[model samples]
Target: MIELLQDAHFWVGVALVIFLGILGYAGVHKIAWKLLGERGLKVQAQLDEAGKLRAEAEALLVQIKAQREAAEKQAALMLETAKEDAIRLGAEAKVKLDEQIKRRAALAERKIATAQAQAEADVKAAAADLATQAAETVLAARIAGAKSDPLIDAAVKTLAQRLQ
Candidate 1:
């Protein structure tokens, strides 16, 4: 036993035992365990925060998708309304154009009829003037060869005025 105590290996073993005894006496093991438990709790809290943020992001995404669908539906409705308005306006324009064309044609016909009536009246007046001149020439020739009577001369003057 005295030889084992004097050996270098036995002294190293004794030194290692004393070092471990000092660490145990100081409660280093309890401190290490407490630090590890605190680290695990911190990690768990971070994971819970991450999970809450993911849930919020998913909710926001769903709301955004719903809004997008509503916007698309509104856009389609507006487009359909615009198309209907265009078609209605086109129809109205066509009706107006047709009415204008009919009115113009009727006005043209009325103008042509008036012009023809005026022409007929002018022709009639010219025929009456020619007839009056021929009658005056025949009466003058006949009266110059006949005897001059006051009653006949007055009647001949009144006949020329009545013909005109």
Candidate 2:
């Protein structure tokens, strides 16, 4: 028993036991356990908040994707509508241009007819003037060659007036 009391290892064991008993009497272990539990609860709450934020982010991403798809569809529809309108307008323009060309051709034909009519009238007037001059020249020659009776002179004057 004296040897055991003198052993260094036994003294150390005794000292450790006494220190543990003091800590228990002072409630230090309970305080340490409570602090650890509180730390654990804080970490769990942080994890829950992170999970909620992640879920919200995922939902927002999905909603944004849906909106983008809708916008793309709308854009495509607008493009198609624009293309159809362009085709329709192009056809309309072509039709109008064709109509204008036909109108111009008809107008040209009318102008040509009017010009031909004017030319014909001018040619007839010129022919009539030439015939009148020829008749006047022949009558003058006849008058110079022969003495004219009053009755013959009257007839010639009437004929000249009629020719003119």
User: What's each prediction's TM-score?
Assistant: 0.75, 0.75
Candidate 1 C-alpha lDDT tens digits along 1-164: 99999999999999999999999999998898999999989999999999999999999999999999999999999999999999999999999999999999999999999999999999999999899889888987888889878887788789889888
Worst 10 residues of 2 by lDDT: 155-164
lDDT of 2: 0.92
Please write out the lDDT profile of model 2 over residues 1-164, one tens digit for every residue. Answer: 99999999999999999999999999999999999999999999999999999999999999999999999999999999999999999999999999999999999999999999999988988888788778777976797688867787787678768866
**C-alpha lDDT score of every prediction, in listed order:** 0.94, 0.92
Off by over 4 Å in 2: 1-14, 139-164
Evaluate model 1: give its TM-score.
0.75
Which regions of candidate 1 deviate over 4 angstroms?
Answer: 1-25
- The candidate scoring highest on lDDT is 1
